[model samples]
Target: MFKVIAVAGSPRREGNSATLLKAALAGATAAGAQAEVVYLNDLSFRGCQGCQPCTADDTCRVQDELTPVLGRLRQADVWLLGAPIYFDGVSGQMKLFFDRLHHLTNEAGQLRKMLPGRRAAAIVVTYEDKPRDDYREVAQRLANYLGWMGRFDPVEVVSLGRLGPSDAAAARPELLAEARALGQRLVEQLAQQGRTDG
Candidate 1:
């Protein structure tokens, strides 16, 4: 069975980002994929130390709660990342996590481990009524980074805006449905690729 990991970067467990992530995981599970969710706020971890140890060994030197998460990400067939927009970008939790992903590449800027044909989806939530392109750009940049570092192709970005309240997303059934459908579609696409390869 395909393995999928959903990382929630919001401090609020039931916040918009986390809710969407849970919905996505539910859809992935229903689609016959092994799905797991990681709440970054629940874990105690530090940002990248700039030690550059990964440049030599292709592995992060600072080991913490995020160590296991990095391992799981390496093994998963699909990655679903969800975070709220903060100051025109992803939350601090998500940014720290992204920094830790420096281990994915080497000094030469080459991927330390190639995960070809993998898939990824980024869910970005914003409170601003007029969701600026900056938010979408940030999400798209994340998708592009994953594509370059992990060989994840066709990364999808689901941007939700005007969610001022924590429960705002819950009120929008359409948004949740969209997230679920994206999850299912990703798994189905991977399954199809596996069949075609076999």
Candidate 2:
């Protein structure tokens, strides 16, 4: 029963998305969460072919990088998906992975039982020049999609946007505080469940 599963959906290993996610994951770990981080860039996977085999077999027929990772994701009590926004949306790699999850969704279009009874959270980091809610639009849509397919609405959505190297350099204390808070929130939720499932 792992407490939380953190997915780093950035193509670049050391990209901003991964960096911020690490901060969040560090927080979760400090709060006593047994967290495993999956770096999607290291996995070899293709976009979903739209075949309905998983519906019949209750598993994806096209096995590749996602087979084991999806299993880990299914067993997790909380899923923390972190991705960078590109061109006003999630990165291509992240979108491909989510699209592949279609195979695991029930015929009625709900998330399969494998992912039921869990909570999801989205951590999106962007360097958008504008300070508007542009990132929130995409983040909420992602959270909504997860709610529909994963059967678990998000308990929280954290956005670290408009940040530059300067922020990380000049405001380390504030950044660390946010990271700790994120971690504490994740662990508190899992502890509320009284145990880990994945």
Candidate 3:
């Protein structure tokens, strides 16, 4: 079975980003992939301290709750990252988790592309304002970063907007459907590339 990691970066346990991420995981599971959801809020960890300990050993030296999670990333076939928008970018939790991914680089100070072979990734962002072309840039930025890590395909970056404060994304069937489609599409891409080695 293919392994997928769905990361939810929203502080709210049941917020829009989390709901959408769950929907994507559901789709991935239905497609016969082993999918797991990781909530950054639930993990007790600090951001990358810039000490670059990973440069020497390719591992984060802080050794908090995220250490095991980082280990899982190396084995996952796909990554689905979802976060809420804060100040026109991903939430602080998401940014910090991403920063820690420096461990994916080699000692030569170049990206090691953590996961093996031709991998896949998806990025989802939820915003309170209306959807704008530029709003997708945040997701695109992460996608580009992942691409540089050797997952060169264009990531299935998704942007959701105008979600009400108390409205779980389930109320927005369209968005939920889109999230599902994105998940299924990601799996299809992986299968096409024959990277379902798990």
Candidate 4:
């Protein structure tokens, strides 16, 4: 079975981003893939300290909640990142998660990456504003960083906008469908690559 790691980067419980992430994980299961969702809000971890201890083997030395999670991330075939936009950028939790991923890069300035093998990833972002290019940089930069880590181009970027309590992405059928499609596509791509570990 292919394993997918879905990350919910929202601080709010049952928030729009988390809801869509769960939907995507459901779709992955329907596609014959095993998936796990990790909620950043529930974890007790700190941002990277730039200690460079991972330089020896690319293992973060923080020894917090994120340590084991990062280990699982390295073993997964696919990754799904879900976050909410805050002030035209990704949520603070999401930023911290990404910051901790510096272990994937062996050298400063991304000259060398230690993470072995390429994996597929999808990005989901929920925003309160209308869909615009201004907020796209965050996701795009994430994709670029994953590329630097030897991961495949981000399989999808789902940006849901005009979101409020009543207009949550989960409540929007079209957006939910998009989330499911993203998951299905990720599994299909993994199958095509013969990446199933089971």
Candidate 5:
């Protein structure tokens, strides 16, 4: 049982979002939890083509980096989705990931029976300062969608706005602590429910 699985939605390898996510993973590890990171940039995921073919088997047959990712998401305890806001939404790279999840299910708009009981967390970073509600709005909607599919709602959502890649290091003291606390909270919650993975 893995403690946590973090998926990076940023296109940049060491971007602000990815850096913060790594800090979160470290915090989870400090709490005696295991963590793994997957970067979307390294994957060969094809954006949703709207073929509507996965409904037959309830799985995407195009077969790429996302195949194993979906399989891994099933067994993961805590999921960390870190993405930078692009035009008030997540970048296209991560947007494709979300789209693929939709395509992974059936025509009835119902998630496959394989998805349920999974715990997740959302970390949204943006260059837009002044604390915009876009990230929270989108993240909450995403969480609601996941909850409808029977996946556990995220224990907390972190919004770090108006940050730059250079500032990520300096923001470590504050954001890093938030990310760490997020990790410990998720681990404790999952453990209390007998989920040893977190």
Candidate 6:
């Protein structure tokens, strides 16, 4: 069975980003994949210290609430990352979590230690009434980072705009449906690749 991990970067548990992530996880679960969601706001963790220990050992030395999360990310076959745009970027929690991912590559900037052939989805929620190119670019940049660091292939991006209210995503069935479909597609693609490999 494939394991899927969803990380929620919003401080609000029922916020738009977390709501979309939950919907996606539901789809993955229905598709016969084991899914789990991690709420960053609930966890107490610090940002990466930039000690560069990972340069030689290829591991994050700072042990905290995020340690186990990093471990699970390495073992999971699929990743779903959701974050709300805070001041034109990902939330502080998400940005800190991303900073620790430096261990995925070596000091030479070459891809070093990461699971190969995995899949990922970048979910970004913004409060802007009209989605800006910069917002989409943020999601795309996140997708690119996951692809480069985790060796995820075909990283899908889901960008939602005009979500000023915490329940905005919950109120929109179509948005939830879209997220669910994306999750299903990820699992289906993985299964197809497994069959092809076999």
- Model 1 over residues 1-198: C-alpha lDDT tens digits? 888899999998898988888888888888999999999999999999988768766688988999999999888877899898988789999999999988776655555544445555555555545767778888888887786566564478877778879998888899889888878888888877672242
Write down the lDDT that model 6 would get. Answer: 0.81
Model 3 clash count equals 0
**Whose lDDT is higher: candidate 2's or candidate 3's?**
3
Clashing pairs in 5: 3-197
TM-score, model 6 to reference: 0.92
**How many clashes show up per model?**
0, 5, 0, 1, 1, 0
Q: For candidate 6, write residues 1-198 as lDDT tens digits.
A: 888899999998998999999988898898999999999988899898988878676789999999999999888888888899988888999999888888876745556645455555555555545778888888788777775565576578777789998998899999999888888888888887772232
Give the alpha carbon lDDT tens digit for every residue of 35-122 in model 4: 9999999999999999986765677889899988998988888899989998889999999999998878776543576656556898
* Candidate 6 Cα errors over 4 Å, as ranges: 107-109, 195-198
Global fold similarity of model 3 (TM-score)? 0.92
**Candidate 5 structure lDDT:** 0.71
lDDT of 4 at 82: 88
Looking at model 4, which ten-residue stretch has the lowest summed lDDT? 108-117
Per residue, candidate 5 scores C-alpha lDDT tens digits across 1-198 of: 445888888877677788778878887887778898999988998987777767666676667878898788767778788888887788888889878776444545655543555565655555556677776787667666555444564556677766866456346687778777777777766667664232
Better of 1 and 6 by TM-score: 6
Clashes in model 3: which pairs? none
lDDT of each: 0.80, 0.67, 0.82, 0.81, 0.71, 0.81
Query: Residue 176 deviation, candidate 3, in Å?
Result: 0.8
Lowest lDDT 10-residue stretch of candidate 3: 146-155
Please give, for residues 55-147, the per-residue lDDT of candidate 2 as tens digits.
655577778988898888777766777777777787787888888776555654444554556564655655545554867777767776676
Candidate 1 least-lDDT 10 residues: 108-117
